[model samples]
Target: MLQKNVLDYLDSSAARFPHKLAFADEARSFTFGQLRACARGLGTALADLGPQHNRPVAVLVNHTAANLAAFFGVLEAGHFYVPLDLQMPLPRLRGILETLSPAALVYPAGEETLAQALADLCPVLCAEEGFAHPPQDALLDARRGRVLDIDPVYAIFTSGSTGTPKGIVIAHRSVIDFTEWMADACQFTHQDVMGNQAPFYFDLSVKDIYLTLKCGATTHIIPKKDFLFPTLLMDFLEEKKVTALVWATSAFHLVANSGVLEKKVPSHLRTVILGGEALQAKQLNRWRAALPAVQYTNLYGPTEVTVDCTWYPIQREFADGERIPIGRACANKEVFLLDEHLQPVPPGQPGELCVRGIGLAKGYFGQWDKTRSAFIQDPRNPNYPDLIYRTGDLAVMDEAGLFTFLTRQDGQIKHMGYRIELGEIETVLNSIPSMEEVACLFDPERDRIHCIYTGSQESKDIAKLARASLPRYMVPNLYHKVAVMPHNPNGKIDRPKLKEEWIHGNDHRL
Candidate 1:
């Protein structure tokens, strides 16, 4: 059957696995039947609350089963969901709300105070109350009938270069295509239980959420606090009998670096997929050593590409210093590299990674200018309108058509009349046995390269290693050692924060 709406996934799964747990959190869970009931009921209420159709419905709540229900509920009501992280500051949240101008704002019960603050912007709907509303089948069916594959399903906000967040709007077709390809590529089954680590607001979570619905599998929303203690996280996965893990590379690195996997591993974990940053072989080797039989996949793409356009299933052993290719493009998607002139780069040369096909997002919501800047017409085609998203990420394609991500376009800087990639320096430093984490930044004002890292090695030793490996200009001009590396909410290194603190704020130590 052709799936026009994402709700179709939930409806089919609900019928097939009525009594099975669909989503679960630490405090509560929802069976497929019950989740469908909650969604229908909430959909009816949302339909009655406003007359808006195909608009954004902002959902501000913690990561829980109820939150997932709210997401489906928004879709059931014929509008796209915009998940807002509860931890987001009011200023940023306000900015997003101002830009979204959603038809309604859904919040968990007992958060009336927070909800009320934004009530002026939109109608506030209590998720708990909405779940209790009686389902209007005819009304919901009518709404569902109106939905189309090209309509937006959700909009996830990502940081823009200009400081404001850009809401990346994804259509149902894009997600449907991506999710279908992911399920087939990853070989997901109903028996697989997923341990979801990415926050719902982040696009990475899309795979865990939709894949479970598509496969009729169960998903356990691992608590954010569990990630801090690797042992506790492993225990949760073990207790839940989680067979799959869709996580960020940082989360994987945390567990491997913590040495918890050496002592104890998630015995039932069979598949591990990582993204949102480069996957270092040092940490990956640790996981492979611990779970030799487990399938490991490295995914690459920005949020604008509907989660991921390329994936590399680990096939052979890699040394700690080797780089893993992101592999070929996924089904129903096309990924290619283009140089600054918008021409295909020669094989093995770095170029901006561009993506097209069914998996590409609709574009940024309410920011047409910004959207036009990133999502442009395919230069190769002038006769017809064919769109491709410019990812701004630099990567190199090998002779075999496998892509190896290098760094962000901004991460490549001109130093001493030579263009160098910061990621290359970090990759080299990361290969060091004693180096735990490393980030390279450039100081344009002083014309120096700054290397901030958390490792046991002294600054002098790291400098010596860099001198031996990198060219004189490519070697870091400054090295700062810290006990711990800072990360953002999505688990990627907070380079901007590190730059503010280590590079711009204090340089005396360097």
Candidate 2:
């Protein structure tokens, strides 16, 4: 049965196992008792902020234990949090604030400089200690109440091709729906030690935080420094006896293909979840060859739907297919494949993916028109009907009626007035034996689509490879090979970083 609220999940889990270990990053660990106290304290401190209190609170932090603490703490406080990593540039960070006018901001204890910059607009809170301490025994008394059934919980910004950013507003109800669906399927326990490889700003951290607090389980969080070292990551996973993991496709690929992960798999690990981007079969094959005992899963969802809306449990009979199909809708959420006319498209035809139920967000912040336009009232069902979020990604249903993702419907360009699929061309390029990874983006201002590639391909041969697979306009006007493609906190290819480098020649705006 669905509870009256999502925070009650922690209440129930805490009662069941209060003294059990709850969180573990690299340097610290906390029990359920400690974790709850910190969350409630922080929640109490912000409770007095009135009904207008539902505005966005910006956070400049990383994936530390403090970040997770603040994530739940602020959500429980009844305000939506917008996390911005400290690693992003000042100009980009300023642009995000200008677009999404948050109510308050939080920063790491020592980042006084950043906090000072934000203090003029909203109150700035500094968290120096981990989630387990500091906030405890505070003089600030919270006006305790209940988390509203319809309050927005958080907002994540997606890079907009329109020279702006879109902040997706998710609510507490959606978080509960996703947590319930995930807990039932994953079967986590206090015995499991999970790792947090993603940044707190990313949606992947939602699972890492909730599952730990739910079971009083311990989480092994990796620091920013270790992301560059593949061997160190393998050692961390094995040393901590990590039973489950939530990360991007690239993180696991770094370990599976690295010679250190050969033959020795963690025996206790039961589930390995991958999301935030596409997963290739070759990456899965490499991990399966080593960690045969670990059951794998590929999760899919936009920030609009909490963390995940659908999942495909990786099976042993895995066959090599062109693309991995994003599985059925989550337990409490409703999934619909709709045509251009907003009607349900039949199986095996391309259409837009529409989502409803608790998994759907309240809507985009500050953009009521876009919100109402995208979150449509479904004409199909009336009883318990909710607005459906229109996912702009184009998808086709499989024979089993599951969704097979093709590409983003809006992420294309027009050259010579002809429409082009930037992703399709990149997919073809990545298929070549010499290519390792590729990114394709259109520069509308430049009137040209550009590509930045990584691998062993010679600069002279890029045009040849494109000639074999891509049409004339689809082929990039310029190509460059670098050591590796950069990624933002969300694990997607960092196009801002790419554009910055292309413009300034040595900018490290990561």
Candidate 3:
């Protein structure tokens, strides 16, 4: 029988290579059979929660083997899982809970305070104790049989235009399609060893997780703290013999320039995939110079689309500051440039990049208004109605059909592989007992978040307040106090002018 759901991958892998290592983290490792059995046990334990189709079971835990079990468990119970980052602030986490209103909150054991605090909103399931019950084979088989490809497998939350975070739900069919394409395009096999870097909450982990499962490859989860010491990271890679790496641009830059690659090279590293941000030619050259035989690729996509929509395998050398093309769209998917009137733009002209295909998300979890606005009807296909996601990113396609990114059409920025809304940071800054205006800027060269504001509160105090409300990545690294805010002719904040002045050394560092 054809596999219709994501859970089927586990069942097939367990049967084919029951003793083969499926996934390993710093704490422990799990074989294919062990992973499948544990997930089944977890599903049986969560059966009483009434996991219906489309309902969400929010999992709040760190990156660990237990978290993976919770994810598969939710799918086994005929529901979707929303993985939350435990490091996020409580206020931000609460806001997501309010927006999602999940059926239950799944956390690790010994977190009684967290469970009690969120118990009022919904039930909390402990991962350590939750799966203690034996596998209920009948119930698991029944739910598995009912799940369809169109039903959502998981939901990820991204920074919203509004103050709250928006949940983006992806279905099993989308993952199945993208995973199949990636496996064939990249030529993955059971002999490959994947080094997982991105956190489970982030969408980048999707490619690492699903691709490993589809190819029957082993994935070793590098600890977060290891990255701080690049030499230790190199040792881990050398020890695990990681052959493939799908990581953020920052992670590649950190390792390539940390001097560890020059001193000691990863003997088994063969392929390096970068996404979540633009890859600088200088950074690419540094890695290539050290490991000349490695295959490098630039993958681009938003959370709305399953992981990546387009890919560019590096073939030729590039100079410093050169713009890299995002290359063509993936198989079975089409990405074209569309003008403001929803018409096809002329070749070589800048326009919004619109994507049309099955890889698109079902829509925002529950925000009908936002979902309808972003995912609209394809104007060119009026004869038969079809939906295409209007990516707010602007780009230009050349005669060769390759896309070169221009700039973001909105205030959204990808920092440290996280898609953050500048407005979200400004909202929190405005709430901090401030006197006046504020603006957030992402410095691509330095990879820093800059916050400029005209306020009475000290920058240190404001930073402290922000730390309490926002995640560490969203907090501004540099704070500047300006005397007056620049405005355009429309009397609105001239962000361009502010960014120019900040870069040109016209403002005082607070």
Q: Who wins the TM-score comparison?
A: 1
Count of residue pairs whose backbone atoms collide, per candidate: 0, 1, 0
| Residue 75, model 2, lDDT | 62
lDDT for model 2 comes to 0.71
Ranking by TM-score: 1, 2, 3
C-alpha local distance difference test of each model: 0.91, 0.71, 0.82
* Residue 126's lDDT in candidate 2: 66
Q: How many pairs of residues collide in model 3? A: 0
Off by over 4 Å in 3: 160-163, 411-507
- Candidate 1, position 342, lDDT: 98
- 89-131: candidate 3 lDDT, tens digit per residue: 8888888888888878889877778877888888888876766
lDDT of 1 by residue, 1-510 (tens): 788998889999999999999999989999999999998889999999866689999998688889999999999999999999877998888889999999999998878988888888999999999999999998988888888999999999988555679999999999999988898989999999999888899889999999989999999999888878888998999999999999999998888888898889888989999998999999999999999999999999898989998999999989887888888999988899999999988898899999989878888888899889899999988999999999999999999999999999999999999999999888888988888888999989889898998878999999999899889989999898888899887788988888888668866844
